[model samples]
Target: MTTTVETIRKGRKFDQVLEGARQVFMADGFEGASVDDIARAANVSKATLYSYFPDKRFLFMEVATTECQRQSRDALDSIDMEAEPREVLLQTGQHFLRFITSKFGQQIFRICVAESDRFPELGQKFYSSGPAVFRAEMAAYFEQAEARGQLHIEDRILAVDQFGELCKADVWPRLMFGMTKVVTTAEIDRVVEGAVETFMARYGV
Candidate 1:
């Protein structure tokens, strides 16, 4: 596929806006971030910024959605669909850990949790686009594994939920409150191993 200049420029501008918005939102919260501040941070004129995002709310939503989509895509891309079930689970877990620990991911999670009440639609959008999609993908993976006789999950949905719970044992709490230190590769490997072992015990070849 040929790449167009407009496409490249749009992508670059989108990333610039997202980065600026992330900083502003993290520093000032959703209510406090202003279009002026975002434009200033992005080194773009207000008119230029507005050309890309009509309003602050739209900009914030785009920033959050971009981060969420990036993380979700990373998780999906990391998994090798044709690999063994355990390998797939481990790869998924590792990528998930990386995503949650990333700077953009941390800021977006905080923004969502902090502004969820005021921006109910934002939360819904995020859920629909991110975790909901991720869960569905995972469920499909589990279903395929069961069909292939690599596993025997009675309920793919529940299995998907369990997998999330296992991964979140370390990831969620850390993201929510920074209650734990950043997860290392070793820690990710350990968590993945334990998760895989537990999952296999319940449903394996």
Candidate 2:
């Protein structure tokens, strides 16, 4: 599958190589993907690929990191910080968790999980670029909610992290293991509703 990384902004050739590498890596796990494969997919010479990315690992890191950022923006950018806490949280939770449970999301997570040990930087990159970005956005949202007297958040960062995990509590684990694949609107609503209820119980004004 073609990895969607619309948020990645780099030199044309550089992004081209990354896009190629992302497709190859997704199709053929990290260990299976080769520089030649990426070069061929990108229509650049091996030398050109290496010039942009010193090594296959670095290329993979960039693709994975960009993927994280892309997914974060895909879901988080639409959040209305000025909205009510319940509306914002519920909306964000629904979109975020739904994206996480998607095929593309599952593939990226698997890539990180599988190659993280061989390349520990992958985990750090994934976190710093993806989840951390989301957490920061959520924290800002929570801060706004607190300012509006809609939520009681003494630690906005921590509270948002909790809220993020709460959204994943019921759905995301099953996703990682391949136990569940299909996602209906009913399932998303159930998960988001539960998370919203629990979060409001603890932090509601």
Candidate 3:
């Protein structure tokens, strides 16, 4: 009986437990979210919860990974990848900023950071699933755009990273540092537009 991530996902109550954990984690964060509370939230006994996830860290990682995959899929799907570079970057920037400034996004980041010292793997897993995967997807798009003569990116990886940072500029930091609690649509648009402009200034053909 190998109770790995794959096996855990196959459990009948996997989604239920994941949802319950996500709710609790969002509310209380990793350090504060107790197993007892998670089980109660899922309407399952502690034993049942453990049966699906032997460790709390595993559960948290699963929640973060699953959410990241879903977010990436949804965001990419909504964007017209075949559009002009400016339009594509604009849409991608908007989606990126919107998510990173979101409550769930912030929570996921905080959990990874807060638990990093004790469990380095937590941060690693989050980065791999979230940022790393995202960067790769962006790079693939940039390469295609370059081939189409829509952009001229000598270093796709660096360009992708820069674009991400540009999107984060003010909104992401303010939210992360408690400088602002709310981000209006105007703010998202402003930042995303700036990101696209800067990115295109360097890469647009």
Q: Cα deviation of 19 in candidate 2 (Å)?
A: 2.6
Deviating ranges (above 4 Å) for candidate 2: 1-12, 23-37, 54-57
The TM-scores of all predictions, comma-separated, are 0.75, 0.78, 0.85
Candidate-wise lDDT, in order = 0.75, 0.78, 0.85
Q: Candidate 1's residue-wise lDDT over 1-205, tens digit each?
A: 5321122235457777778877897678677888889888988888778777655665676677766777788778867887889889888877776676665566566666766776666667777878888889988888888789899878888988898678767656765775775667777778778888898888997
Better of 1 and 2 by TM-score: 2
The most accurate candidate by lDDT is 3
Least well predicted 10-residue stretch by lDDT in candidate 1: 2-11
Q: How many Å off is the CA of 71 in candidate 2?
A: 2.9
Instruction: Give me the displacement of residue 105 in model 1, in angstroms.
Output: 1.9
User: Backbone collision count in every prediction?
Assistant: 0, 0, 0
lDDT of 3 by residue, 151-188 (tens): 99889999999999999998888888889998999999
Error of 1 at 73 (Å): 2.9
- Give residue 110's error in model 2 in angstroms: 3.0
True-vs-predicted CA distance for residue 151, candidate 1, Å = 1.1
Ranking by lDDT: 3, 2, 1
* Candidate 2: worst-modelled 10 consecutive residues by lDDT: 1-10
